[model samples]
Target chain A: MPNPTAAMLVIGDEILSGRTRDANMHHLAGRLTEHGIDLKEVRVVADDPRAIQEAVKALAGAYDHLFTSGGIGPTHDDITAENVAAAFGLPIGVRDDARAILEAHYEKQGLEINEARLRMARVPEGATLIDNPVSGAPGFTLENVHVMAGVPKIFEAMVEGLLPTLTGGQPVVSQTLRVERGEGDIAGPLGALAERYDALSFGSYPFIVNGRFGVNVVIRGQDEAEVTRAMQDLEKAFPA
Target chain B: MPNPTAAMLVIGDEILSGRTRDANMHHLAGRLTEHGIDLKEVRVVADDPRAIQEAVKALAGAYDHLFTSGGIGPTHDDITAENVAAAFGLPIGVRDDARAILEAHYEKQGLEINEARLRMARVPEGATLIDNPVSGAPGFTLENVHVMAGVPKIFEAMVEGLLPTLTGGQPVVSQTLRVERGEGDIAGPLGALAERYDALSFGSYPFIVNGRFGVNVVIRGQDEAEVTRAMQDLEKAFPA
Candidate 1:
């Protein structure tokens, strides 16, 4: 059976405006790949309710899983939780369980659970809370959609808590061969080799280093033998 | 008038499979921000023709401009050009101008223009070529969509070449204030300030350093005076 497909929806204005470089997407991509979940697509949208809602609905419906990062905070710009609720037609309010978690966390630190802070406790109906070990704010999982915080440390922690629970398929293995020639020099043979190995996925990443053009040919497959064989063929096709 | 909105479609299997971290999206976001083009959305899809075609069509139709990076090479996985053509119902073939450019580039490097290499010359009908100073395989602009190479160096070069020709709006200006308190401590006052200055966009990015939690409040607006005033209000709301 094929691996369960997943998609990511990254919600933040800091990312859209280029004020912040997104680290969560790359982190999730690596983690999902290791969990044997195929991350098929990723979308980054600003902190707009309509955009978040639309992306959440579309990705959640299309894939077996949808993981979202960002906009789940205490500030005014954090609207992801509400928008996610709207996407699934679920009524959202500060659930007692979530509120209790936040209240205890704040009480421990001698901090007040103000109105804006209480916003972080708002949870969509019929959702299970995902543990956030790094911070007090908890992430939530509604159906197949997992919503996590945007902070890298907190996001990574939430992912660690969430991944082991989900079912996974065979992890994909990849091998790469760096060729010291321009892509144009190897394209013909590389193309022919890719056609021969129908099971393996072939990717060519071009790079120019020290005024010398080269390509890194990456061969990936769920089956290790198939990937190895494809790599062998690539080496033969472009002998050093 | 509002700034022209843009979206980016990043095409590559390397990115989805967690083999490569995408740098082009961040670079484009920063550049587009400087050019006063609001980058509204960004999508990263694997090197699949259907995904590419669908994303290209959707982003192209919805936004004022669509910029794509990746899969524009000579290898078998380089299918972005063809898929982009299919999205617009444009017939694709080896255009003489594009072929000539590639042929000259290869000749200078003492390389052969093989069948796979010739694939780089395929251009969609009624499209204009975007210059690639680093390598010869030219990116193309079809209507409002500009396709560029995925390599960071080449992609940056293409963006530099493309930015000058397009019209831009007033650049957005932003200022940030770092507070040494947890977000929960400042959320109430920050939310109230955000409500008062509706024109400025306020974002709070929380961080945990040395076991101490803090938040960086960023205020953005096209109007400098409005942003400054909002920052002043934020300082007053959370006096040190």
Candidate 2:
């Protein structure tokens, strides 16, 4: 079977303005890849209902799985659940299951589940809750979309809870070779070699580390043999 | 005047899969601060056209300005321009201005502008081009959205070209103080200080660098004096 495709939606205002550098996208992406899912895309949208709704609907339809982080807090900007509900054409209201979770949480801590805290109880209809053991507020999954907290710690916990159920494919393996050459110099030859190895995916990332023009060539594929062949060809093309 | 709002769309498969750790969003966010534009949202979508279209439309409507990076390149996955045009219900064709820019670039390098290279000329109708002096394939600004190359160097150059032309508010002045405390420990007092300064924005980014918990408290506002005052209060609340 083909690799299951996934996309991530990072929803927050804190991340975009350089106020926060996101660790969630990187963490989730690595996890997804290791689980044998091809993470095809990610979109970082602000805490806007419309933006979240539109992104949720589009991504949910396109990929096998869609994951979202952020806008699930107790703050005014936390509108991810409502937007996801709107995207699914479902009503937004406090779910008893979610409320039970939050109620128990606040009760244990001797904290009030006030209007602000109770807001976390709101969940989309027919969505199954993804348990957040770290914090009281539960992450939820509906159809292909998994909506989790923007907080890195909470997000990781939910993914750990959900990974076991996923039917992952053969693990996608990769090999990287560093070449001291400009992308423009290597583009044509690399493109030709990439074409020659149709089974393996080739990527060229150029960087200037310590004032030297260097390119990191990555070859990825599900099949180990095909990846090996591609690596051999790459070595022949640019020998050390 | 209030701070100008902005959004970013990072379009790439590599970023989501952990193949690339994105630098563009962080770079753009910091630069936006200098221009007094509050980058309120960031979405990293894949190379998928549908994903790109949805993200672009949503951000363009919500934010004062939107910046998109990645997929505006010379590869099969480079569909940002086409998808962006579709989002706005605009026509995309090989634009004359873009063609002229690419032609000049190729002419200088004595390289042929092949069918593959010519793909860069396709741009949305009614979009003004943003010059990329490094690569010479001009990025375009359509409506409130700025589409630029995904390559870090190219993206940086394009942002530099566009920032001076944008209508920005007073540059947001910021001061950061380092406190060796966990976020939970500091969350209460910090929230109170933030409430006191209604005009200024304060954020606490807690990290465990070298096995010691430290929270970097940042205050942002137009007035340097106000920002300084808030910082002083923060210091008093959580002294060294």
Candidate 3:
């Protein structure tokens, strides 16, 4: 069977405005790939509520899983959690369970939970909280959408915890062979080989090293033995 | 009016599968910002024809311009040119002008243009070719969608050449200030300040430096005087 598909909705103005280079998409894509979940599409939208809700509705409805990163902070600009709830037409407020988690977490640090801090405890009705070990505020999951924080370290930690619980297909394995010749010379053979294999995906990434054009032919498949065989086949077909 | 709203469609499997971190989006976002283009959204889709066509239609229609990177190469995976033509219901074939340019480039390097190399010369009907100084293959502009190469240097070169011919609005300005306090403590005052200076967008990016939580508050606006005033107002309001 094919791998379970996933899509990501990055909710932020920072990325679109060129204020911050998005580190979460690459990290999430890598983690999902390892967990055997095929991340198919990723959309980076602004902090606008309409944009967030529209993306949430579209991506969540289209893919098996929809992951979102950013705008889950205590600040005013952080409006993802509420907008996500609105997208699903659910009631959102500070839940007792989430509040307790924040209270205990803040009590340990001898810091009182202010209104801003209390904002993080807000959860939509019928949503499961995703643990954020890096910080006190927990991310939440509503339907097929997983809403996580924008911070890199916190996002990574949340993903590490969340990925294991997801149902994934066979772990894909990939092998690459670097050909010193230009991609134009290798396209014919590579295309023929790809057609022959049919199941494995062949990606040709070109590079220029020492003023010489070359291509890195990456063969990816669920079966490791098949990937190895394909690599061997590639080497034999190219002959250096 | 809104800095000529723009969106990006990144076409590749490398980004989605997590093998390659996309440098193009960040580069494009920064360049567009400098060129006074408000990049509102960015979508990264696979090499699938349906996905590419769907994104092209959606983004191109919604935004003033849609910039695409990748899938314009000499390999079999390079299917963007033909698919883009199909999206607009336009016929695509190798044009003489593009063929002449590629032929001259390859000839200068003592290389013959093969069938695979010749594929790069294919242009959609009624499209203008975007020059690619880094390589022989040229990117093209079909209506508002600008198709560029995937390679970082080549993509950058295409963008540099393309940006000049496009219309732009006022260049956006930004100022950032680092505060050595948790976002929770700063949220209330920051929110109030944001309400006062409605024209400027304030983004609070949190970080942990030496076990202490802090936020880098970035203030951005098209008006330089307004951005500066807002920054000064922020400093005065926070007083730290």
Candidate 4:
């Protein structure tokens, strides 16, 4: 069976403004890959409601799952949850269950559940909560879209808890054979090998070692047997 | 006037598959920000022709400038050049000017300008070349889109050469005030300050230090005076 496809939507102005280097996309990409989910595309947009809603609608409709990071905190910029809810035309407000989670956590810490703090409890109707083990706030899952915090620690934790619940196909496997030759020298045989193995995908990356650049040709596919066979052929084509 | 808007398209299967971590997006974001060009959106798509072409057409049309990285090399997987041309209804082949540059580079390196190597010389019709100082292969610019190498060093060089040619608006000025309080505590006043300054943008990021998390509120705008005034107001609201 084909792998379940996914897309990521990263919403933040700080990222686009170059103040914060986005760590979530790479982290999510690695996690999703291991879980047998194919991450097809990623879109990073600024902190505008319309922009967020539009991206949510488009990505949610296109992929099997759409995971979003950032803009779910308790600040003026934390507009992702509401915008996501708006995208699906769902009514959103402070839900009793979410409020209960925040209330219990705040009570344990001897802190007041102020209005701004309570903003974290605002979830769309009919959305289930994704536990944030690192912090008190909870993320939400509405339809196939998962909304999580922007913080790396919290986002990673949410993904770990979330992936096991979803169905995924066979995890893709890859093998790389380093050729101590220029990409130009490797391209001909590699291209021919790619054509022979239509089930696999090839990627040629050039890198420098001891001041001499060489190509690392990688073979990837869902079937491990096919991947191994292709790797064997690639090694034969460019014998070290 | 507003800054010239821009978007980035990252074309690579390796990045989407998590075999490679993308450094170009963050690097491009920093460069575009410093150049006074507003980066509004960024999309990372797999190395598929339809995916590449669709993303190219959408981003290039929506933004004033579109910068693409990856898929221009001497490999079967490097299909970005032709796909981008197809998106614009332009014919593509090995143009004389691009071919001459490749030949000269190869002659200097004492390497034969073989067919695979010559693939780097393919240029779309009417597109101008963007110099790749780090490597011999040249990138190209068609309409508002600038296609460049995926390698970090080569992409950086191409961006450096390309930025000086395009017109940019006033450089965005920013100020950050760190508060040793939770984002919930900081949100009310920060949201109010954000409302007071209609032209500026506010971003509140929560960070951990010594086992305690604090909020760092960033204020950004094109006008230095307005940004400074807003910063002053923010400091007054959260006096240390």
**Candidate 3 Cα deviation (angstroms), residue A16:** 0.8
| Cα lDDT of model 4 by residue, B76-187, tens digit | 9999999999999999999888889888887888988888988999999999999977668999999999999998888988999999999988888899999998888888
Best by TM-score: 3
- lDDT by residue (tens digit), candidate 2, A51-164: 788889888998999999887766444678888989999987898989999889778866667766677888888989999887688989988999998768879989999988
Which lDDT value does model 4 have at B218?
91
Best by DockQ: 3
Q: Rank the candidates by DockQ, best first.
A: 3, 4, 1, 2
Which CAPRI quality tier does the interface of model 1 achieve?
high
Tell me the DockQ of each model, to 2 decimals.
0.83, 0.32, 0.88, 0.85
Candidate 2 clash pair list: A41-B46, A42-B44, A42-B45, A43-B43, A43-B44, A44-B42, A44-B43, A44-B44
- TM-scores for the candidates: 0.98, 0.74, 0.99, 0.98
lDDT of 1: 0.92
Off-target runs (Cα >4 Å) in candidate 4 are A209-211
Q: Where is the poorest 10-residue window by lDDT in model 4 chain B?
A: B207-216
**Could you tell me how far off, in angstroms, the CA of residue A25 lies in candidate 1 after the best superposition?**
0.8
Find the 10 residues in a row with the least total lDDT in model 4 chain A: A206-215
Model 2: DockQ vs. true structure? 0.32
